[model samples]
Target chain A: MKLGIDAMSGDLGSAIVVEACRSFLSKNKTDELYVVGKKEELLALESYSQVTIIDAQEVLEMTENILAIRRKKESSMVKTMMLAKNDEVDAVLSCGNTGAYYASAMLFLKRLEGIEKSCLMAMLPTYNDRGVALLDVGANSENTAEQLKSFAIMGSVYAKNVRKVSNPKVALLNIGAEHHKGDEVHQETYKLLESMQEINFIGNIEGKEILDGDVDVVVTDGFTGNVALKTIEGVAKVLVKSLKDGFMSSTRTKVGAVMAKPALKQLMNKFDTKAAGGALMIGFVKPVIKAHGSSDAIAFENAMNLAFDMVSSNVVDKMKEGLK
Target chain B: MKLGIDAMSGDLGSAIVVEACRSFLSKNKTDELYVVGKKEELLALESYSQVTIIDAQEVLEMTENILAIRRKKESSMVKTMMLAKNDEVDAVLSCGNTGAYYASAMLFLKRLEGIEKSCLMAMLPTYNDRGVALLDVGANSENTAEQLKSFAIMGSVYAKNVRKVSNPKVALLNIGAEHHKGDEVHQETYKLLESMQEINFIGNIEGKEILDGDVDVVVTDGFTGNVALKTIEGVAKVLVKSLKDGFMSSTRTKVGAVMAKPALKQLMNKFDTKAAGGALMIGFVKPVIKAHGSSDAIAFENAMNLAFDMVSSNVVDKMKEGLK
Candidate 1:
C-alpha cells in the first residue's frame, strides 16, 4: 500500500509527521510512503528505500481559509490529495488544517459519483467497548435531508467494510428519540433513514446514547456532530485532569493513586479518540484520513494503520456499490 | 415567594415532588409552595400553612407531544405555569416532560414582551471550578439569528443577576473560534452578538472552550446546545462509573479507594449538575426551573433553591429591561 502524508500542517509541525512515517515504514517494509512538504525541509531527512519525498512549494497554515487550497495550488495538503487523485498513492493522511484538507480532497479527489458531499467519520469510544462511528464531525456545517441520507449510507459502508461490523446499526443523531424530533430538516432525515432497507437504520439516537455502545454508527449534520464530538472530548479531558489532580493532592491520596493508576489508565484508554487512530474523510473517490492536530507519533502511526486498512479493504469501491 | 410545583410529573410522581417541596419549605421559612396535581393523590400529604394544594384533572406523559399542553389544559405542568402566569406563584419547577413544560411556559408566559422564545439555560461544570451557563439547551431546536441574539442577551442578564457574574463574557457557540465558523446561522449570530453593547460578547467559542471555564455564558441554538449538554452528562456518568468500578477491583485498590473517596467526591462534586440544581427556563415572564427528569427529592429541592434565587433577584424583569 502507498500512503501520502501532509507533513507541513498541524500544531506539531513537519518533524513529528516525518518521524511517525519513518517509524511506520521501518516496521511495515512492504508499504511505501510519499511524504509531501517543503523541498528543503523534507530532503534534509534520512532516506529510506520505502520512502519518497514530494515537495510542494507552499504550506497551508491552520489559520488559513480553506479557499487557500484553490489559491495555493502547490500547497502540501492539496499536493498530497493530488497524488491520491492520480492513483500514485492508495490513500492520504493529514494532521494539518482540517478545513483545508477537507477542501483539497473535495477539489482534487471530488466526491464519489453518487455522493453529494464527503463526511468526516470519527470512531468514538463507548462504554460497551464497541466503538461507535460518527459522521460529519465538521465537514459541512449545514446539511439537507438528502445529504444526511447520503451520510447514513456512507457511514454504514465505512462501519461494515473498514470497521468490520456486520449489519451496522445506524442511528440519526437528535435531541430526542422521537421521529418528529429536531427541526424540519432532521424530521425529514429521520423519515428518510427509517425508510432505508440497505442500511440498518435504528431510528433516532441522542448525544447520551453515543457512548452507550448499542449503536454501531451515528450520523448527523456537521454542526451538531462537531459540537457533540468536542463536548465529549472537553468533558473527558476535564474529568481525567481532575482525577489526576485529586490523586496527587496529598501523600495518602498519592498512595491510593499508585494503587489506582493501572485502573485509571485503563478507563482513560476506553474514551481515547487517538486509540481509534483518526477520522476518515469518507464519500471521496479515495480515502483521506485526518489525524488529530496535536497527534503524537503514536497517534499518526495508528492513523496510518487505519489508512492501510481502508486501502486493503477497498472501502471507496464498496461505498460506491452500496450507494448505487 | 410562592413557588408552583408540578407534582404529577417526572420519573418519580407526586410523592417525590411533594417531599422535595416539603424539604425546601422546611428550611426556607419565607417561601410558600403551591403543589399542583390530582387532588386525591396530593391530599394524602401532611399540610403546612405555607403550602397550598391545587387540583389538576390530567397528566402529561414524557412520551406525549408538547401540543398535549393545550389538550391536557388541566394537567399539573400546565396548571403550574398558569399559576405563574396569573401571578398566583412567584416561580415554577418541573421534573417532567421538557418539551411539554417549555410549550406550556411559552403559551402562558408569552415570551416576556419582546422575546420571541424562552431558553433552557443549563449550568455546565468546567475545569476552573466555576461552571459556565449554556442557553437554549432544548427549547428552540431551529432558531433565527435574531433569536440567538436574544438568547445571548437573556443569558448575560441571568449570569449577571442570578449567577452573579458581573460583566459576564458571553460567547456564540460554533465549530471553530474563527470569525466565520459553523453554519450561516451561527456566523450571523456571532456578528449580531459582537455588535450588541448590553452583553459582553466574547466572539465565537468552540465546544471544547465550554468546559475550559474561560467564558461565562455560551449561546447556541437548542439542537446543538441540547446535544452538547447530553454529551457532557453522558461522559461524566461514564467516567464516574468507570472510576468507581476501578476502585472495587481488588483489596489493595479497595483500601486506596477508601482513602481516595473524599478527594474523588470533591472532584465529582465539581461536575455535579444536581448541586448547581436544574436548568432555568429563561426569557419568560417568571422563572421556570426544569430539573432533571430522573431527579430525586434532593435534586428537586436544589432546583427550588435556584428558582428561589431567580425570583429574589428579579431575573425576569431584569432580562425584560435589558432586552428592551
Candidate 2:
C-alpha cells in the first residue's frame, strides 16, 4: 500500500510527522510513504528506503480560508491531495485547516458517482469498549434531507469495512427518540432512512445516548454534529481540570493521587481520542483522512495505520456499492 | 407571595413534594402554598396554616401527548397552572412531563403580548461558579429567526432579574463563532441580534464555550438547545461512572478512592444541576418552572425557591418591558 502524508500543516511541526513516518516504516516494511513538505524539514526521513521526499515549498496556516486551497496549489496539503487524485497514492492524510482540507479534497478528487455531498466521519469511544462512527461532524454547515441520507449510507459502509461491524445499526441524532421528533429536515430524513434497504435503520437516538454503545453509526447535519462533539470534549476537559485542582488542595489527597496514578492513566487511555486515530472524509472517490491538529507522533502514527486499513479493506469501493 | 405546586405529576411521587413544602414553609412563613393533588395523598400538608391542599383526582402521565393538556383539564398539572391563570397564585411549579407542562402553561396563562412563542429556559453551572441562562431548551421543536429574537429578549430579562446579572452579555448559540456560520435561521438571528440595541449582543458562541461563563445568556432554537444541554449531562455521567470503575479495580486504588472521597464529592457538587433549581417557561404572562422529573426533596425545594424568586423579582413585568 502507498500513502501520502502532508507533513507541514499540523499544529506540531513537521518534525513529529517525520518521527511518525519513521515509526510507521519500522513496523510495515511493505508500505510506501510519500512525505510532502519543505525539503529541509523532512530530510530526516530520507534514510528509510521505503520513504520518498516530495518537496512542496508552501505551508497552509491553521486559520486559512477554504479558498486558499485553490490559490495555494503548491502547498503540501494540495500536493498530497493531487497525488491521490492522480492514483499515485491509495490515501492521503493531513492535519491542516479542516475547511481548507475538505475543500481541497472536493476540488482534486471529486465526489463518488451516486453521492450528493461529501462528509467527515469520526470514530468516538463508547462505554462498552467499542467505538461508534459519527458522520458529517463538520463537512457542511447545513445539509438537505437527501444529503443526510447519503451520509447514512457512507457511514454504514465505513463501520462495516473499517470498523469491522457487521450490518451496522444506523440512527438519526435528534432531540427525541420518537418517530415524530426534530425539525422538518430530520423528519424527512427519518422517512428516507426508514425506507432504505441498504442499511439497518434504528429509529432515532438523542445526543445523550450517542456514547451508550447502543448503535454503531449516528448521522446528523454538520452544524448539530459539530456542536455536540465539541460539547462532549469541553465537558471532559472541565471535569479533568476540576479533578486536578481538587486533588492538589491538600496533602492527603495529593498522596492519594500518587497511589491512583496507574488506574487514572488507564481510565484516561480508555477515553482517549487518539486511539480512534482521525476523521475520514467519506463520499469521495479516494480515501482522505484528517488527523487532529494537535497530533503528536503516536497519534499521527495511528492515523497512518487507519489510512492503511481503509485502503486494504476497500472501504471506498464498498461505499460506492452501498450508495448504488 | 402565593405559589402553586403540582404534587402528583413528578416521577418521585407526592411524598417528596410534601416534604419539600414542609421544609420551604418552615423558613418562608410569609409565603403561601397551594399544593394541588389527590387530597388523600396531600392530607399531611393540611396541618400547616401556610399550606392549602387543593384536590385534583387525575394524574398526567409523562408520555401523554401535548393535547392531553386540553383533555385532562381536571389533572393536577392543569389545575396548578389554572391557579396561576386565575391570579389565585403568583407562580406555579411542576416536576411533570415537559411537553404537557409547556402546553398547559400556554393554554392557561397564554403568552404575553408581543411574544410569538413561549420557551423553556435553563440555568447551567459554569466553571467560574456563576450560571448561564440557556433558552429554548425544548419548548418548540423548531423556531424562526423572529422567534429566536424573542427568545433572546426573554433570556436576557431572565439573566438580569432572576440570575441577578447587572448587564447581561447575550449571544446566539451556534456551531461556530464566525458571523457567517450556521444555518439560515441562525444567520438571520445573528443579524437581528446585532441590530437590536436592547441586548448586549456578543456575536456567536459554540456549544463548547457555553460553560465557560463568558456569556450570561445564550439563545437558540429548542431542538439544538435541548440536544446540547443533554449532551453535557451525558458526558459528565459517563466520566463519573468510569472514574468509579477505575478506582474499584484494585486494592491500592480503592485505598486512594477512600482518601479522595471528599474532594470528589466537592467536585460533583460544583457541577450539580440541582443547584440551578429548574427550567423556567419564559415568554408567558406568569412564571412557570419545570423541575427535573426525578427530583428529590432537595431538588424540588430548589425549584420552589426558584418560583419564589421569580415572583418576587417581578421578572414577568421586566420581560414585558424588554419585549416592548
Candidate 3:
C-alpha cells in the first residue's frame, strides 16, 4: 500500500511529520510513503528506501482561506491530494486546516458516484472501549433529510468495514431519544432511516448516550455534530487540567500523583483522541484522513496507519456499494 | 420571599424534597415555602411554621406527555405552577418531567409580554468558577432569528441580575467562531445580535470555548443548545467514571486515591452542576426553575435557593424592561 502524507501545515510543523514517516516506515516495510514538503525540512527521512520526498514550494497556513488551496497548487496539502487524484497513492493524510484539506479533496478526488454530500467522520471513545462512529462532524453546516440519510448509509459502511462492527446499529443524534424530538429535518430523517433495510436503524439516541457505547453509529447534521464533538473535547481537556491542578495542590496529593502515575496514564490512554487517529472524509473516492491540528509524531503516524487500514479494508468501495 | 416546591415528581421521591425544604426553611427564616405533593407523602414538612403543604393527588411521571399537564391539573408540577400564576408564590421549583414542567409553566405563568418564545437556560460550570449561562437548552426544537435575539437580551439580563455579572458579555453559540458560520438562522441571528446596542455581543462562541470562562452568556437555538449541554454532561460523567476505575485497579493506586481524595473532592465541587443549581425557564412571567430530575437533597435545596435568588433579584421584571 502507498500513502501520501502532507509534511507541512500541522501545528507542530514538518519535523513531527518526518519523524512520523520514519517510525511508520520502520514498522511497515512493505508500505511506501510520498512525503510532501520543503525538501530540506524532510531530510531526516531520506535514508528510508520506502520514503520519497516530493518538494513543494509553499505551505498552507493553519488559518488560510479554503479557496487558497486552488491558488497555492504547489502547497503540500494540495499536492498530496493531487497524488491521490492521480492514483500515485492509495490514500491521503493531512494534519492541516480542515477546510482547505476538505475542499482540496473535493476538487481533486471528488465524491463517490451515488453520494450527494461528503461528510467528516470521527471515532469517539466510548465507555465499553469499542468506539462509536459519528459522522458529519463539520462537512456542511446544514444538511437535508436526504443528506442525513446518506450519512447514515456511509456511517454504517465505515463502522462495519473500518471499525469492524458487524451489522452496526445506527442511530440519529437528537435532543431526545424519542422519534418526535428534534427539528423538522431530523424528524423527517428518522422516517427515512427507519425504512432503510440495508442498515440497522435504532431510532434516536440522545447526546448523553453517544459515549455509552450502546450503538455503533450515530448520525447528525454537520452543525450539531461539530458542536457535540468539540464539546466532548472541551470537557475532557478542562477535567484533565483540573485533575492535574488537584494533584499538584498539596504535598500529600503530589506524592499520591507520583504513586498513581501508571494507573492515571492507562486511564488517559483509554480516552485519548489521538489513539483513535484522524477523522475520515468518507464520501470521497479514496480515503482522506484529517489528523488533528495539534497532532504529535505518534498521532500523525496513527493517522497514516488509519489511512492504510482504510485502503486495505476497501472502505470507500464498500461505502459505494452500500449506497447503491 | 415565597416559593412553591413540587415535592412528588423527582426521581428520589418526596423524601429528598421534604429534606430540602427543611434545610432551606431552617436557613431562611423570613422565607415561606408552599410544598405541593400528596398529603401523605409530605407530612414530614407539617411541623415547620414557614412551610405549607398543598395536597396534590397526582404525580407527573418522568416520561409523561407534555400535554398531560393540562389533564392532570391536580398533579404536583401543575399545582406548583398554579401557585406562581396566581401570585401565591414568588417563584416555582420542580424536579419533575422537564417537558411537563415547561409546558405547565407556559400554560399557567405564560410568556412575559413581548417575548416571542421562552428558553431553558442552564448555568454550566466553567474553569473560572463564575460559570456560563447557556440558553434555549430545549425549550423549542427550532427558533427564528428573532427568537435568538430575544434570548440574547434575556440571557444578558439574567447574567447581570441573577449571576451578578456587571456588564455581562453575551455570545452566540455556533459550530465555529466565525461570524459567518452555522446555519442560515444563526447567520441572521449573528447580525441581529451584533446590532443590539444593549448587549455586549461577543461575535460567536464554539462549543469548545463554552467552558473556558471567557464569556458570561452563550445563546443558541434549542436543538443545538440541548445537544451541547448534554454532551458536556456525558463527557464529564464518562471521564469521572474512568478515573474511578483507574484508581481502583491496583492497591498502590488505591492508596493514592485515599491521599488524593480531598483535592479530588475540591475539584469535583468546582465542576459540580448541582452547586450551580437548576435550569431556569426564562421568559416566563415569574421565575420557574427546573431542578435535575435525579437531584439529591443538596441539589434540590440549591434549586430552591436559585429560585429565591431569582425572585429576590427580580430577574423577571428586569428581563421585561430589557425586552422593552
Candidate 4:
C-alpha cells in the first residue's frame, strides 16, 4: 500500500517527518511513501531509495486560519490532500492546524454518500489493552439530531473494521444515563439512534463511564466531546506532575523514586496521548489521520501504521455499505 | 453557630453522621447541631448532650424523582431544608439524592434577590495546594446569558469571601480560548462578562486549563460543567487503579511498590475528592452544602467545617450585597 505524508505541517520541523517516513519504509521495504514539502528541504534530507518526494512552494503554519486552505492552493498540506483525492495514495496524514486540515479534506476528498459531516475519532485508553473510540472531539461544535445519528453510524463501522470489535456497542455521550436526560438535541438523537438497526446501539452513557471499557464506541457532538477529551487530558497531566513533585519532596522519597521508576513509568505511559496515534477523520473517500501537532517521530510512524491498517481493512467501503 | 445535618441521607447511615457531628462538636464545643432523621434510629445511636434530634419519618433514595421532594414532605432531606428556610439554622448539609436535594432547596430556600438560579460549586484539585472553584456542575443544564453572568458573580464572591482568594479571577468555560469560539450562548456570555466591572473577568478558559491553577474561578452552564467535572473524576479514578495494577505485575516491581508506597500514597491523596470537601449550592438564602454520598466520617467533618466557615464569613449576606 502507498501513503502520503504532509512533512511540512507539524510543529516539529519537516526533518522529523522525513525521519519517520524513512523508518517506516525501512520496515516495509515494498511500501511507497510520497513526502510532500518544499523541494529544497526535501532534497537536503538524506533520502531513502524507495521513498518519493513531492514538491510544493508554500507551507501552512499552525496559526493559519481555515481560509488559508482555500487561498493557498499550492500549499504542501493541500497538495497532500489532492493526492488522496486523485487516489494517488491509499491515505494521507498530517499534524497541522486541525481546522485547516479538516477544511482541506472536506474541500478535496469530499464526504461519503449519506454522511452529512465527517468526524475526528480518538482512541481513549481504558483499563485493559482494549480502548474505546470517542468521536467528534472537535470537528463540528454545533450539530443537529440527524448529524449526530450519522456520527453514530460512522463511528460504529470504524470501530468494527479498524479496531476489530464485534458488534461494536455504540453509545451516546450524555451527562446522565437516563433516556430523557440532556438537552432537546440529545433527547431527539437518542430516539433516532434507538431506531437504527444497523448498529449495536446502547443507551446513553455518562461522562464518568467513558473510561470503564464497557462500550466500544462513544458518539457525541463536537462541543461535549471536546470538553470531555480535554478534561481527561488536563487531569492526567496534573496528576503526573503532582506525583513527580511528591516523589521529590524528600531524600527517602527520592530513593524510592529510583526503585519505582520502571513501574511508575510504565503506568504513566498508558495515559500518554501519543501511544494512541492520531485521531482519524472517518466518512471520507480516503482515510485522513490527524497526528498530534507536538508528536515526535515515533508518533508519526504510528499514524502511518494506522493509515495502512485503515486501507487494508477497506474501512471506507464497509462504512459506505453500512450507511446505505 | 448552629448547623443542621440530614443524618438519614448519607450512604454510611446515621451512625457516620453522628460520629462526624461528634468530631466537630469535640473541636468546637459551643456550636449546636440538629440531626434530622428517623426518630427510632436516632434514639438508637449513642447521643451527645449538644446534639438535638429532629423527627423525620420519610427517607429519599438516590434514584427517587425530583417530585419526591414535594410528595415526601416528612422526608429527612426536606426537613433539613425547612430548617434552613425558617432561619432555625445558619446552614444545612446533606449527602442525599442530588436532584432531590437541589429540588428541595429550590422549593424551600428560594433564590436570593437578583439571582435567577443557584449553582453547585466544586473545588477541584490543582498542581499546588491552591485549587479552583468550578460552578454550575449540574444545577441548571440550560442557562441563559443572564444566568451565566449571575453564576460568575456568585462564584467570584464565594471564592473571595469563603475561599479567601482576594480578588478571584473568574473565567467562562469554553471549547477554545479565542473570542469568537464556542456556541451562541457562550459568545454572548463572553461579551456580558467582559462588560461587568464587579468581577475579575478574565476571558475564556478551556477544559484543559481547569487544573492548571492559572484561574481562580471557572464558570459554565451546567451541561458542560457537569461533563467536565465528571470526566476529571473518571480519569483520576482510572489512573490510580491502573497504576496499582502496574505495581503488582512482578516481584521486582512489588519491591519497588513497597519503597514507593509513601510518595505514591501522598500523590494519590492529592487527587482525592474527599479532601476538597463537598460541593456548595450557592445563590440561596442560606448555604446548602452537598457532601459526597459515599463520604466517610472525616469527609463529613470537612463538610461541617465548610458550613461553619460559610456561616462565619456571612457568605450569603455578602452575596446579597454584591448582587444588589
Which 10-residue window in model 4 chain A sums to the lowest lDDT?
A42-51
- lDDT per residue for candidate 4 within B151-229, as digits (tens), equals 8988898889989998899999988888788889889999999998999999998888899988899989888899899
On residues A1-324, what C-alpha lDDT tens digit does candidate 2 reach at each position?
899999999999798899999899888989899999998998889788898899999998998888998889999999999999999999999988888998899888979988888988888988777779888887778899999999999899888898899999999999888878999999999999999989999989988888888899999999888888888888888888888888898898888887787778877998898778988899998899999998899999999999999999998898888888
- Model 1 pairs whose backbones collide: none
Model 2 alpha-carbon miss at residue B38, Å: 2.0
Predicted candidate 3 versus true structure: per-residue lDDT over A1-324, tens digit per residue: 889999998999998998888888788989889999999998888888898889997999998999999899999999999999999999999999999999999888878987889999999889889999999999999999999998999899888887888899999999998888899999999999989999999999888888999999999999999999999989888888988998999999999888888778988899888789988898889999999899999999889888988899999898889888
Docking outcome class, model 2: medium
**Any residue pairs clashing in model 3, and if so which?**
none
Deviation (Å) of A81 in candidate 1: 2.5
Query: Per-residue lDDT for B79 in model 2?
Result: 97
Instruction: Compute each candidate's TM-score over C-alphas.
Output: 0.92, 0.97, 0.96, 0.95
Which of candidates 2 and 4 reaches a greater lDDT? 2
* Model 3 chain B weakest lDDT span, ten residues long: B105-114
lDDT of 3 at B108: 81
Which candidate ranks first by DockQ, i.e. highest? 3
TM-score evaluated only on chain B, model 3: 0.95
Relative to the real complex, the DockQ score for model 3 comes to 0.81
Candidate closer to the true structure by DockQ (higher is better), 3 or 4: 3
Best by TM-score: 2
- Looking at model 1, residue A173 earns an lDDT score of 93
Ranking by TM-score: 2, 3, 4, 1
Chain A (alone) TM-scores for all candidate structures: 0.92, 0.96, 0.95, 0.94
TM-score for candidate 2 (chain B): 0.96
Among all candidates shown, the one with the greatest lDDT: 3
